[model samples]
Target: MFEDIIGKMRGDFDIKPMEVMNLQPLVLAYIGDAVYETYIRTMLVVNKKTNVNTLHKMSVNYVKAKAQSDIVRRIMDKLNPDEQDVVRRGRNAKSVTVPKHAEITDYRYSTGFEALIGYLYLINQTDRLLEILRLSVEA
Candidate 1:
């Protein structure tokens, strides 16, 4: 289902899937941020319907930079070497600016976490992606 959606999106845009290894770390983080937020929102909505404002506030607990950084810290030891390398590449990637609300360290680490999520998604590793996402929620 995930692959189908990604493929359809690519087809719609007439864009070929880029080689994951050759893609910039920030690019991965970009998609990862969206995917992570979507997952959290979906999880929340599926559990129970709520006011949009309430849902947004609840989702923030999981999707915020500090929360993501904490989640990554808890699960880092469980990642394979390749996943760790992806995180490192993402964390070290230079960006033009940081969000005003996040600490620098939290922002960097959250970027790394998002990159790992994006890497797994791009590679079509659904099981591992879901595993990590589940762990993130638990964390």
Candidate 2:
């Protein structure tokens, strides 16, 4: 599904994956959070077509730090060496803000997950990104 969208959108802009590699993990995560939110919101709208409030509530189950942490745990071993490197950088990088209500470990894992997502999004690797996103929620 996402593949078709990407095929059409690819010509819309050009990108450099190497440039994204130079960005800070937190900067990657910033874009990643937005990418993830849009993905979840799109899934909700396409799958259920419910009211906005209900969709938002349902999205909470998937977007929370704990959930993200667990999903990243599930997918970590499946990542390739390069992807693992990205996750490692994101996991170990210090952040200025701590999660107000989430465990530190979970927050770190979520950041790693978001970093990967942001990296993929910036590089216009939509197919690979969607593949990872599917792995994220498969269970």
C-alpha positional error of residue 51 in candidate 2 after TM-score superposition, expressed in Å: 1.5
TM-score of 1: 0.87
lDDT of 2 at 26: 84
Each prediction's TM-score versus the true structure? 0.87, 0.90
Cα lDDT tens digits for candidate 1, 100-137: 99999999999999999888777766678878988999
**Candidate 2 per-residue lDDT over residues 36-93, each given as its tens digit:** 8878888888998779999989999999989988988899888988788888788888
Best by lDDT: 2
lDDT of 1: 0.84
Per-residue lDDT value at 135 in model 2: 83
Positional deviation of residue 9's Cα in model 2 after best superposition, in angstroms: 5.6
lDDT per model vs. reference: 0.84, 0.84
